[model samples]
Target: MSGLSVLSGGFIAGLFAAVTAAWVAVGRTVGRRPRPTTAAVFLMAILLTIAAAADVVNAYFSYLPRLGDVVGAATEGGSDPHLKTADLRLSTTSATLRAHPRGAVLALPVPDRGSGFGATTALVYLPPQYFDRPQWKFPVLYLIHGSPGIPADWLRGGQAADAGARVAATGHPVIIVMPRMSHGWLDDPECVDGVGERVETHLLRDVIPTAESTLRVDSGWTNRGIAGMSAGGYCALNLGLRNRSVFGSIIDMSGLTRPTHAGGLGPLFGAGPQAQAAMIANSPDLYIGGLGPGPRPRIWLDVGRHDRTVAVAIYHMRDFLDANGYPVQLHVRSGVHTFTVWRPALREALSWFADDVARVSAA
Candidate 1:
């Protein structure tokens, strides 16, 4: 289950979609042989049945209720001894930033240090084991959401909580932090150290420090991990690469190799040469080839076979990782760049990260 086969759900979903489309295509042929057509129909019928079963399994166990009773137990009314009181700087907000029970969802205040986009809120999930030992410092995973997305997207839109539940089942201690990555209502933070948003610095400067100070997160770089999808994925790569001293591993799903746009880039980054320069500097492709052995972190990159939009860039990233002698795990599942691909990717990453942390913590 920990192998590349972790992508079976995505592959099955893609196969289902393709078979459903093939069913339509075959039905549309006007003058086809009846025998061949019948065979095609029979094949599609069997495939569809199998696809339906997979979908049901994914929805109930993988998607809908990832945590089930475990999530409820964590969020319910109880005292978590390991919970660290958030150092709320703003007045009248400390009430909402109190100690949480194991598996509780907490809203933490992260001040915007660069983007000037008002006060930021990061949603964090405390695993069941977090409250079991009062003095234990849990490993942390920083999850990022894409543009046009909120912190809650990981909580609701994806199976992050379910993934956490799955991680907890391994009997490891971990913490999940979902920080607000968007700079504005219509902004793409680019997740780079740039002219406008500077979300990268925000993460290294504000987010990490805040989490370390407010939560019972282990500060060692080996105990920290980062991952994101789409734009957030790109950010994860950038931050994890440059801040290798902080993150021990990273998971990039459908991430862009470079910063580009179908439209003009003036709006997203800036309209000046400096912004263009920053974009080029932020391109992970530029740095991948030059990476040395000093600070190597476990890297995982995944994309869907049918995900035409980001597939090319993701492959480029995989190529760099392979060519540069960096030990990486790259997977191409049978899916598009949607939840079908991202959810499982996150789950596998979390599981692997937990195992990695356990091995390190044990040592």
Candidate 2:
């Protein structure tokens, strides 16, 4: 069980104990009178029922998908208003700084070719200390956003840049890169070299090299980590596992282990068993098993307990990794398939990378 679950359980148990003690006190105060008044008994039963219902609701909220409001007032314009405009100011400490610190919108030139759609853009986040330490080459964490979202999703919804700035303020300087994947979905091209548009090539060949060359970043794999949310999570695991030489670690936050059989994947990539086989090969759980031991990248896999859709798949992937003797850090927490869960998950993942990447880079 995860820490959140354990804490919730303890809270519920304590509530029950408190209620029991109250009941005993009331019974003793009644002085064992012959048969308690019907009204008093009825009131006690109602209160107990209410308490039970509250506990159930609390548990459900803790694990199930958030359903109250689709868009909160805070995200009114699909952007976080809390992010200050001054935060967007670029510091002279780094030349790679992109996007206004206050807003999530960023406009970077896409690679000329092989980027699919003739337009390839990257979302860049520079830490607050990036300008303070001109001599330091900070590590990089490349985050891929999920479907129906562009490169700016991490900045807009996940508030990645702000989070990066906060971590940087703590003295753990790093850069966060969010790239726009073809079609905005993981199974779109299956992250293969030449499936439909060469997205894998664009990312591994073009994006990484361009970032290293243009930015003041550490070029070694030890200083690099990849991660994502939802479909992006799937991409992170697939790409990170395959290119372990480039990415030293991976953080998968609420990602599905396998593509759905809904036939969308087939039509999107092309046709035939060869294509299907290629797609399956890119799945981390499917291929990681074959790699067989040795120094695999540091992996962190997590999912919300209430996320019924992908939680089972994540569980299977975790089991597969453990059975294959692969090292993994697994976390099952209280949340569902929504930004509420992803926000916290992303924060924790970043902290994990901050600690691990620093050690690897120092070594």
Candidate 3:
């Protein structure tokens, strides 16, 4: 049932049938007087209809591909609070690569001492070439999910593992790792080191170091890239620009100009003069021009042509980066700020980023 597509004709038809049956049961209650049981049945039918409609909307957005994904998100957090390396080993056997050509997704606990945000697990996507080539060091691409999201969002909604595998087939394979961004559902840290949340330190200090030590990936900045969608996109841009020595490239898909939250920045930075300064430090637009002389990282700003609000806002950013002599690409495609647009973008970006990594490695 988990593999069943909610958009499939059979699945939609069954949902419609169930909803119709529920209404029919409610209709039968209408002529039986105003009994309490009749009212209860009518209420239940209304709830069923609403829930069915909600599921349809959810399917359209591709947020939850499988029924099991809902349960997985709720139980994604771990009990371990200590930062440690995952006990994993690389398999170079040809039989293992033949058995699973696309590669596999590993769920590992990535507790970090930097931020102590240890209640989550990171998802790693190892391409088939990882097992086929024993001595080759693959480029690492860190993919971040949107707000109110978990690491599995990239797998279930964005189809990130499938996208990475497709790029791998082109002989430019990359190790794509999705790490937990926020402390909780609806908690939007915007990947900044503000107040009590040191999200930036978590990714830079803990996640990257542990992955490099444990995995057979290139350790140089030129062999590393970062990409994200929505809130995660903002993070990719902010973190990549702020730490150019850490990431060689950045792919921002439908991101904002600065750190944002539905509740505003008050909760994130707190109330103080230092808080205001931190907010200024985190905003990419404010500091993009101040970046000193160095080899600037290549950046790709992707937004939907139909998404006018974000597309227009990021134009000045593209201009600023261009004016500063940084290599930047602005990609405008059809669709909005959802997975419908990001899924294909991730595939193309993985290929492009991996190719650049290969070129630099060859150089």
Candidate 4:
């Protein structure tokens, strides 16, 4: 656990106890008629406790993949990924490094000259089949994580390893590529190219190419899917919808309709027409509204009913997708914006995407 996680847990424990104590304290004081102060204190305590607990939980364990898969270190990669080190750069002159079976995750340090965002290490998940059947190519899924998070977030609590194992057990395998999004947890690029960061270029030009070239994975849209959470969900929709020719399906979860940060859009994208243009270009709502005659890629949208921040926005997106030519599967789960909801939904999504991939292959 990070220091933040410990600090967060301590904070939440104090908060939870304080609120519960307050409610008890108030309840004891209240008589036949409820006092306004008592009522206010009770409501405040309940709401604050819920909000604080959710934040603490997400912060503490956001590093686990939904499935508990093992990760390994390699010597050829130069330094250790455990120490946030680099790997051998992919060179045409060098031999192709095959996926290993000892571990499901291979951390490779990838560079992005186009983005100018500095080099980032991606956590790539290889199924058992990847090693057993070296001759068979597999599908690819570009799974992204929430902003204010790192690439390791997907591995630690996303439950992807469990879902991948389930899929592989069915005689199907997919390469799951999780790239580090922000330079740091606080750096929100909105997954767009701008004055400082050309993040989209990093993913499309550098990350995708690196994964495809390094692994025996399919290179077509029919075999590819994109999904993310929160800000990452926004990127999945932005990248997947705009590049329908590249992604066959997308799972958007608890994503905002527009880009926002701890500061707000004004500071993140700069305040003006350029920001407006960026939002319009990146908004899936905008894309769905102007969708053309041809069928677009499959879209799945899910949000916890109790997702205070994005429940309404998700509903609006669901309506937009339905009313317009493009239709999405809207799943309103029974929880807030936590992995408690996402892990199960992710299982369904992988199954759904695999079905799509299977159908395309059969056709």
Candidate 5:
């Protein structure tokens, strides 16, 4: 039952049936009992019913695939501190990946050198080609995970390692790095350099340099790409476009057009005229309109058909980029804002990026 998929319709139906039956049985058993006892039983049943309803919402969204994910999240303390790390020497390979033909994920402790934002451990997916072609320096793709998630969510939920391996099998492998966006699991900094967290500065000054220095990936601007889903998707577009000299490709999967927080922007941007200006500056769609003449990064926009507001934003961005003579690709699929759309989107975007990098390298 722990391994059962939460997204399965049959499973969801069965869950609802079981919960309803249990609630009904509890009510009947406690009927005509003492007032306090009956009331307690009713309260417990209501709480259980609410939990079942929450599970239905989770099933619809496919936040976590398996019931074990909840247990794992609790048991593992919401972090992968003990995940195996690859040898710093890029030429070597661990016995784990040596036996299998898959890429390996390494935990990297990126330091907060310049940006005051707290840094968490980053995950790097080294393709099979990295060990095979020891002399070759591969392009790097920075994958930003969604909020309410950790770096390991990219591996478990996004299936990023498998996606990177699939792209590697195509003979155009790239180094993929999934970095932590904030200090904790629920921190929603929006990947911006405002308030106490200088996330943008951290990515540019700390994460990028850390990867380049420690990994066997090319540090060239054209060889680097950034991608993310949900809020992280917005970060990829905003960060990649703003730092064209560092990143040459951008992929946004069901992302918003600007920085947002469920608790409002006051904590991150403050309350003043400067706050309004800061918010405007971070809005990708707003600033991209005034983009000056310079190196233009390839843009990939993908959103679900049922994503309504996000879909509209993505379509508008596609049209704007197309009309402005920028290289942009749009992919709209049938789904909502969930991993069902993002996993495939990441795979396709990475393939596209690999092809673009190959063409550039060949040229």
Candidate 6:
């Protein structure tokens, strides 16, 4: 849990305990022939009631809002909140285009760079201004999607196109590229050139080159920023850290810093200890830790407090970075592993990337 959430929980528990103690004390004083069993039952009932009340409050304020924010931020960030009526547009190919108040869509093709996965698809979001002013090419923010999923996950899960438009409206004017990785899981392919499958080669050589060529994008590494959720987050960190020549900044939203130690990774990569060693060597923490305090990308790591699954891993990453003297911005918020937490984290991450992008573009 975050410091605030932990404090809030402790405060509520203490308050309940104090009230219960007072009530028990009062009841004991008033009852001249109090039965021990009756007193015990009354105390238990009071405790249960207090616990239930705390749980309800926690769920409402913390959990519910987190979920709603994922949807609300994506839908509401770049639009007029006061407008109740808006037209929903439809795509030419019968894909439902949800209404957005501040952005336009661009479908870009991912080239076949000999990875055998031919011509992947990527969706780019251009701010509303791009339509009015055609000569401007914005710095690109390449967003990667998670595993057991495709590029569509960011659109469907985070509604990222709408979010990017909203963010772009605030003067960032970024082109958000959602690219599909060849491997279909949330773990990194180590970004190694020819290991199992050259996923990194496909990304850097094919996807990025195609994006830069087709889109009005800034070409230098300093103008590029990468971020992702879950598996996408893993890819972002892996690619950004190892290929520092390409990405200027990296953001990991609930991604694993180290490979899974539970033997799942070996089977996932279809290799044994040696392959796992290579993956670990390419991990962000190891590479970033070894850097000699020169020009490295800005790093942002965030996790939800109640996310029991990845919280520990995230904490280890944060600690490792700190101990290794790597510069990182860490945010631990109150929530679980759901999109509720990730969406807000993503918004904040984009804001950071936008700032970095602006600085680089202006230079």
Q: Which lDDT tens digits does candidate 1 get at residues 128-243?
A: 66655567788899998876455655765465766776788678757888887765423565676555555777787788788888777887878999999877788788888877
Tens digit of per-residue lDDT, candidate 5, span 197-300:
89999998889888888778887877999999998899998998888878899999999888878789998899899999899888978887788788889999
Residue pairs with colliding backbones in model 1 are 66-162
lDDT of 3 by residue, 98-153 (tens): 32457666664666765766645677877777777878788899998787666767
**How many residue pairs clash in all the candidates, one count each?**
1, 6, 0, 14, 0, 1
User: Which scores better on lDDT, 3 or 5?
Assistant: 5
Candidate 1 CA-lDDT value: 0.70
Clashing pairs in 5: none
lDDT of 4 by residue, 266-301 (tens): 655666898788767777777667757664788899
- Cα lDDT tens digits, model 6, 1-363, are 121121244756786677667676867798764477876677677766665665455343232222233344433222334212222222312123333457655566676877665677676765655555566766788887765345655654466665676577688877788776744433344344434567777888888888787666877777788887766677787778777778888888887775442335564355777766676666766666676655577789888888767778777777876776657788999986656777788777887788777876677
Candidate 1: RMSD to truth: 10.6
Q: By descending TM-score, how would the candidates be arranged?
A: 3, 5, 4, 1, 2, 6
Least lDDT summed over 10 consecutive residues: which range in candidate 3? Answer: 76-85
RMSD to the hidden true structure, all candidates: 10.6, 11.8, 7.3, 9.4, 6.3, 10.5
By TM-score, the better pick of 2 and 6 is 2
Q: What is the lDDT of candidate 4?
A: 0.71
Top lDDT model: 5
Over 4 Å off in model 2, which ranges?
Answer: 1-106, 113-117, 183-190, 261-263
Please report, as a residue range, the 10-residue window in candidate 4 with the lowest summed lDDT. 76-85
Q: Write the per-residue lDDT of candidate 2 for residues 1-363, one digit (tens) a residue.
A: 111221244556866676677667666887763255754675578556755665455333232111221232223112445343222233322454433433233334456455554456676776645555567787989888765345655655576866776676567867887776765422354445554567677887677876777667987777899998777788788888778778888888888876443446665456788767776777777777687555577888878899877888888888887777656887888978766677778888898888787766567
Candidate 1 segments whose C-alpha is farther than 4 A from its true place: 1-102, 113-118, 261-263, 268-273
Best by TM-score: 3
1 or 2, which is superior by TM-score? Answer: 1
Per-residue lDDT of 184 in model 4 = 71
